[model samples]
Target: MKQKIAVLGPGSWGTALAQVLVENGHETILWGKNPAQVKEINEQHTNHHYLPDLILPTELKATISLEEAIKDADALLFVIPTKAIREVAHQVAAIVENQPYIIHASKGLEQISHKRISEVLAEEIPEDKRKEIIVLSGPSHAEEVAVHDITTITAASPELDAATYVQELFMNEYFRIYTNDDVIGVELGAALKNIIALGAGAMVGLGFGDNAKAAIMTRGLAEISRLGVALGANPLTFIGLSGVGDLIVTCTSVHSRNWRTGQLLGQGKKLEEILNNMGMIVEGVSTTKAALELSKQLGVEMPITEAIHSVLYEGKDIKIAAKDIMLRDGRIENEFS
Candidate 1:
């Protein structure tokens, strides 16, 4: 059955997911803040700034008005950044009177509150107007997904029906969707892995060999699992797609914005300069701060996240931070227990 779905924020991920919906035969409306970009998506069917050289589906429609985008929509997919999730949810709450399944693809924690994207949505979207909030995450990248690369992702919700519903909505041969009920683990895995990816990219930028990257990824997962478990997430979830799977892809792939940002930082570029040059949100930078805060608050030690935070925010030298991680007192890995 075809459905009307509103995909909010016409960024790379949003545009890519909207394209997936179009292929799924849904009446997809992509919403963006920039009227010029909206017009380009509608008229040219190309988002060159985000997905260059990829032609979007001609049937994939876009609009700048919130009211027009959400009108009669069966589901809403929020693909905006963490900083803007609250504002967008608030806006959606005002315009939406009917309950619609709310889904988010953005992977980052709120900087100030350290809340996950779903938590931010729940706080802003009223229960009456919003149905169950679902999170779609995994090793998938928007660029590859836009070009029909085979990708697998997890759709998680506490409500089994909601997860299964989303599974049906997005499942296809090119894009596979798995359903999970562990929303906490799923969201944490998605957000926390970016910290490790930054470290991985920094390793590459600093000319560290594959051995160093492997060690960082392994230890990074340990720390991420530690902090996630402390926050009531299932430890096993970290080993799943949203956890280790996502960590591997983001940390190793050239397509990851967070890893690329870390690469620039490894090359001694400033954060502001990297952001300006990349012209995209490097989610790991903000996520590092939130993970640092969460680590301190939860009493969970995250050495890699701490090192990345220091390098990105505290003006610490990358080599020195790397050395600090190496010289730390050796302890038995506890994530296994």
Candidate 2:
């Protein structure tokens, strides 16, 4: 259809997605706050700081001015961190004139409100200026997607047509997009899996084997589905691409910042030091806090999330936290009661 799309945030994921859109023959403009990075993308067709060693498509344009990027754009794709979503959405809301399809690739609940990204977007963007928000999520890494590796993801919206539109917009030979109507499940799965990924990485750092990783991931899915269902999400969505699929990729892949952050923690590095050095947002760190709060408020017994929260925020030693999780009272595996 050759639509003009404005991608906010020139991080690894945003740049990779911008590459996909430009290659799909859309007028894709990537907007970043950093002038240096924008200049690099425009002049050299590369974003070395984020997607290092990967050359972006020449047709992909980059800009520093948000107004220039969104002017006359048919859609706006946000790929920034979770904490930045509301601020960026507020900025877009103030200036966006056209009724563009509001789409977000970022995952994580709002820490203060425990609201989903779409919920945050809907709260900020006036109803008259945007269509139903669509969330793009699944087991995808920016490094892999930037190189055209085979990848599959889901575009979820309550409005079926909106999901299908995103599916058509991004689908290609190497990248496949599926449509799901469970926005709640999709967004929760996408956010919660990162917490488990941190745990999986911590297991590795603590010298645990595949058995520990498998247990954390399995039980983590149980916790995620429990909270999600309590919040009105379809239980079936937890097993789909955005659920278990995202869990496997993020927990096992080296490209996951959350996993890497947990690994550093397991290796005895402090959170502040690890985050300062990583130079990328580790979403699970903040998501752990939000999930812990949600668990307490909803009376959801998420032992794993609680354990991770204790380690991350309560100054509990990772070893003791792991031991505590292992020693919790055992119950029947599949009892959702």
Q: RMSD, each candidate, Å?
A: 1.1, 0.8
Tens digits of per-residue lDDT for model 1, 1-337: 9999999988888998999999999999999989889999989999989998889999999998999999889999999989999999999999996788999999999988999999989999989898899999999889999989999999999998999999999998999999999999999999999999999999999999899999999999998888888888888889999999999999999899999988888888888988988888988889999999988998888889999999988999998999999999878776331
TM-score of 1: 0.98
TM-score of each: 0.98, 0.99
Across 83-138, the per-residue lDDT of candidate 2 in tens digits comes to: 99999999999999899999999989998899999999999998998988999999
- lDDT value, candidate 1, whole model: 0.92
lDDT of candidate 1 at residue 105, scale 0 to 100:
94
Q: List the residue pairs that clash in candidate 2.
A: none
TM-score, cand. 2 vs. native = 0.99
Best by TM-score: 2
